[model samples]
Target: MKRIQIEKIFHHNAYRIGVFFDKDFEVIAILKRIGATYSGSRRCWYLDYSKASYHKLRFHFPDLVVVTESSNTTLVTGINNRDLSPIASSSVLQLDSTLSNPEHKQTQITSEKLKLQLLPSIGKYWVFKMHFHHEISKQLLKIKGVYWNGNYKSYMVFRNETVKQHVEAVLGVGSFFGSDYFTKDLLPVKGKIKILPHTEATSWMEVYVPKLVAVHEKLKRFSLARFSKSKNCYLLPAAPIVMDSLHLQFESTGIDIENLLPKNYLDKRNLPNKKQLDLSKTKKSLLDMVPVQAQTYLSSMIDTLLALNYSSSTLRTYCGAFIQFLRYFEFRNPESINREEIIRFLGSLMERGLSATSGHSMVNGVQFYYQQVLGKVDYSFVLPRPKKEKKLPVVLTMEECLQIFKVVDNPKHKLLLLIGYGAGLRVSEIVSLKWSDILFEEQKIHIKNAKGKKDRMVMLPYSIVTSLQLYRELYKGKHYVFEGQFAGEPYSTGSVQQVMRNALKLTGLEKKATVHTLRHSFATHLLENGTDIRYIQQFLGHSSIKTTTIYTHLTKTAVDKIQSPLDRMVDLKSKKKLEE
Candidate 1:
């Protein structure tokens, strides 16, 4: 290589040009002379191929005169004649070199190839257009030459040779995506592929994010690619295999690419998968899975479940459980929940001196937290409820039942109590019973949307039917058999129980009998009449036969006492003492 002296440097059309020793720069080639601008800010020179290079050089290097211009025969005479020896050798060498070379070398850079792969795949293709600059990021399809036409809307690539050569020099490659040779359509013409870009640093790490993720996924197979502060914005090296697998999907499904990519610049390798989270939902402090507005009315969640035709008893159990749960949790939002937190909460319920029934409510509430609230229905850990005391239900005899009915003055209240005990109905089952639920013609009462939201039929008593007919004649309404004072609301279960107590007081029935005792009486009476235990189980809607079996112990045979074996033995010694 020969050194050329920089006599002068000047700018033309925002490009700097340099005039070296003996004006040998002009002897380079025909393409070099036609059009080019130079920038000489840092002593490093570059050319802008769209502008005239020589014209600008003439103004700065005025002291030198050009004598000839015949391809490689350009001659220049300068006033500085002291260094003719160095000038002669350098000038001759430069001329000989350019004249000897008819072709220029071209090498493709990996980054440019990557950019070509990324551009078409990006969903937000408009973002690139938003940052359009004439000379900075001009599209390859726009403009006649490599130079930008200052028109942002242009979409043509550089078609001129000199302009292409200029870009090749600056970018270290020429016509990457611009050429049809790399396209899928032109692979036949281009022959073998050159190279693919891969770096320890990910796309996000680079100052300019070259490839869109949609395209990157096609090029790479990655499942989880995360950005780390240690590696700046680039994807971390851990779990390369997983990320590769995910990338495959991204390539196939261009949709949801942005969702696959993480936003924060931190290692998220420990984070769970979409299906692997501990709780179906997170607590308010951790992550907001259920909307806050929805959680505010936690009771309404249960109500909605009911409205959607879930069992009324399930609604009662779930809502009651949730209410107790909120009290235990001090009415906090049900977010940021973890498995351990729930376990502790369940443990606390037993620790707090709550009954077995209360414990059941808690289990149901927490179960709902996982199922309905978090949308995670797969609960492996089960919270066992405390064992309820096996107490015999208080069932009044037929005479006692009649006594209470006689004392009850209110026709609706009396009918409600009579149906509860006489037909074996729960308070809720009784209140919710519509006129249509009563099948007097068939001597059956249909309970729809009962305990487990199940529908069942119960035998209607002849005596209660006659009383009901009399009551119906006296009272008329739209909905429930016993409607509330308000038009739509049904009579509350508690109100029915209170009315039962009042009727018992008036009738002078001394035995302790609740509205539920009426149901107990129905069950006990069935057993007393020798009805099969399994049949009774089905009638009462008990989940277990053991529940129905409890009524058998209340029967006269089960309740009757047997003489002790010790007492049955003869007392001969005591008899002899008495004879003496």
Candidate 2:
């Protein structure tokens, strides 16, 4: 077995130690037995300054070398101190050459220049005066029992030998000064500010400050820091300028700023808050807002969806739609809400310029909530949904598809685009693929738990087999074929869409096409090549034949083979002229 190398150094008045060894689990067990705990922040194991602990560590590892303030000396038992050169007085400790050295490791102690003055401030506590830099400031803040004194503008901690040793180990030994020795204040007061949504109006914001400080004074000039007696928080008008100023001020003072506004408040402007408004008086103007009582009902609806094993996207859509419906009733009891109210609520949505597709979603979501969760079936007939608009899928030609593939240079992105088009797979299906899903011998790609929670198999394009093999080798140890930055998770849908957008820009194609368009083009091309409609239907995973028939209109196979009657009539007239 290879020898284990351990480097021991005194840092921040504590004995900081690190152990490097081959894949030997025994050494780890030994370190754990010694009560050495790992520090993620320091990236090492440390012990409190104790001479007895140092002697015990040397006993365990007979060949250990301890670097001390004296020189580059070996602490091993029975080793002679002859022929050792005394290092510079500024140097701390130096380990053997075989040990791995960190690039930013400090070789000399510069704490003498670090101006640290400890003095008695109040009963049982001592105040410290020191110039703050990045490294020293972080170390001082990390010391146990140390806290910032806001009034004195300095740091204070309990007086103890352990604490003094830790501070001296980091900032070096300092002299105790008289109470009035230092007068300048270097520390600044810090506080936390929380901004939440106001219940009174949409344009109003609630600011919660634990204590009135300089931040509160700065906020008063903008007429945004009025104290609310009822809420016991500061109330301000929600505006871009107000938010921007608060963000800048809190960030500058090193204060923790927490903004807890609702998604609607952050996304939209000029929205009227319905809390103070008498929304019950106006039935037609009832918008789809979340009601207070709707939370319990929405939770039950979500539980039902999860129990039924619905997809995450479907659950989010259903919950959002139901929340809107419940908000219209102002969170009234769901059992008391009749079908007439549901109809009125959906009508209000349409009047507010909701599309037919959105109207369908609202109708389905409400129906599922009432029928599935509440066990009501009679109200289904009363909630009539609008007809879905008939629209054709955008299909790119073979030449255009080739142009897209040519423009994408990234191997992973190119493979994603190819699989989308080559196998007629949806954007969601392509990203969720794993290494186990690809079957090279069978020439099939298994799609499990796809849309509608169904499973299907698509043919693997022979042309992309080599590229897939190369990609698998490049991105090893991935559960998903196209893994994200985090292991085991599928590639993000937005990233794939961005790749398509870039490719489209390079092709200079005027047609508005997305990643799904590649799948559409694949189906169209297969149909144009005389592939059976039944086969195309299975390939595209369409549940109904009617859904598959839409591609017939996009194909030119039938139209191109037929000759028009007007052209035949013109041919007869030309023949008669030639005979004359």
Candidate 3:
């Protein structure tokens, strides 16, 4: 006869009856189907404790030998084939006497009446449903890895040679019918949860497909999910509720949900299983990357930037530039490298022929380190900065922009370029966008916490709205408007630049342009169309009208209208030559 042990245990913030077994698949499956949840820590399946929960166990498996236990010893048959001790002997437990005693002699339900129902395994378990007396139920419960499905009123049991052998050895083959369903994966699995490296100490489930889009639309609907391109998965907030939600959303898609049990723990380490973050994506600290002598200064600088609530991009740029300065004074004291030495360092950087922009960034990075981080060090000496280059912003003609878009075949890539040229967004602003920022009803994108810690609204052209909706449906990007390879993270700034480069190459445009060129083109094209400079300033998120007016120099239509002196005086020489 099949044997199981039951005892009251507090779990899941409730009193539950812990169902113990000898790893019997059938008994486990029955318990699971009837709403029992498994606890790996307890190494048993559990059901909510109640009168119904207790009697329900016997309702299914009548012949099960239930041994109840106390806080003390739960000894069964000893080596001597007799009770070794009076105080720690095995106990045959009886339920509420009003219930356990049938009150009348019961007719035995025999195995001949139990017709085994079988089908191919849907996933790890064979799915089957049956209606039978408790005696017949005991026969099925003898099989290993069995679980009851309360929803379908079925017992989906494991089918394997190991389980079959266990049954034949424990109970004769004649005791229970062999109803086997081949174990195999059935559903089309489009994704699986992976953990990102950033969350190793406190684990998280990062669900990802092999490629661009996630398998289902609902995965993107998770409010707490964030996309990590470095890990190429949607990083989920570590919570049991999130795991439960994932199971509900992906159970039908079939990607080894049962195997992920270890990841769903409530501990800081969480997921479907306690999957740690990917090792490859773990970033080295700037402090670690710098010379050992300079690490102290770099650590202080990073802490100050974080306390100020600076954007991650700003923190990275400023810290990186400051690290270069620190490296120069690796042997010198950090406090001593402030005034005259800083200017000399700037001169050395200029002498290397770096860009005017790099010079400006380096100045700011160094200034922040001294003023904000060091607190009392007012290094106000005149710094030798590189002369600002006066080159105008590169602007693509409307025809050129259109030609590039036409040559690009990927819908995702095409939409990316169109947003760049049409929306007048900086490359940084574009990549930080989330789908929640889209205001389709207003036909504007709510640019949240943009550069300089300001919010602004930018137009969403009606022409690209359809494309945006279609892209959302096809990609089902969670959170971000232009999600990277997977949902959650905005498309990478590097990927956006690469898309621009690919388009320019395909269109054979030799013009030197970066992703920001699209923004310049957007502003210049608007100016050419006679949009007021103030409105253009708002569209470009420029704090000053002077910044917007730079587009005036780039507008071809305005420049074309003003006839040049050379063009006006051109006809006289040509006319004389024609007459001669």
Question: Which candidate achieves the best TM-score against the true structure?
Answer: 3
Alpha-carbon runs more than 4 Å astray in model 1: 1-308, 311-337, 476-480, 486-490, 507-511, 566-580
Provide the RMSD of all predictions against the true structure, rounded to 1 decimal. Answer: 38.8, 28.9, 28.3
The order of the candidates by lDDT, greatest first, is 2, 3, 1
TM-score of 2: 0.50
Kindly list the per-residue Cα lDDT of model 1 for residues 1-580, writing each as its tens digit: 1133332211322322233432222122212333432322222233432224443444444444331211211213222121111112212212212423323232222332222221332111111111222233434434234332221222233233554455445434555334322122322211111111224533322211224553344333222344345533334232333343334333323223232334443233333432223122222211121234445646445545644655444554565556545544556666655567777876764554455665676687667766775666675656666787677767788788888888877788878887888678888899898888899899999988777667888888898778788777777766678987544447877688879878877877778778989899888888888788887887888888977887877887545566556655556656777899
How far off is residue 491 in model 1, in Å?
Answer: 4.0
Q: What would the TM-score be for candidate 1 when compared with the true structure?
A: 0.43
Model 1 residue 377 distance off true place after TM-score fit, in angstroms: 3.5
lDDT of 1 at 128: 17
Error of 1 at 382 (Å): 3.5
State the TM-score for model 3. Answer: 0.53
> Weakest 10 consecutive residues, lDDT, candidate 3?
78-87
Residue-level lDDT tens digits of model 2 in 1-580: 2254445544443445544333222333355557655543333444433444454556666665454433223322112222222223454334334223323344443543334556434323566765444566678779996666643456776555566566656765544422232222424356788889987876788888867656666566443257888998787767665676566444434567788987657432332322112222121121223344456776688778767877666765677677666656777877888777778877766654566777787888888987889877665455777877789988999999999999989999999999999999988898889889999999999999888989998999999999999888888945788987545557888788989988999999989899999998998999899999999999999999898889899998789888899999999999999999
Cα deviation of 492, candidate 2, in Å:
0.3
CA lDDT of each prediction against the hidden true structure: 0.51, 0.66, 0.64
lDDT computed for candidate 3: 0.64
* TM-score against truth, every candidate: 0.43, 0.50, 0.53
The list of candidate 3 runs beyond 4 A from truth reads 1-285, 377-384, 575-580
**Which candidate tops lDDT?**
2
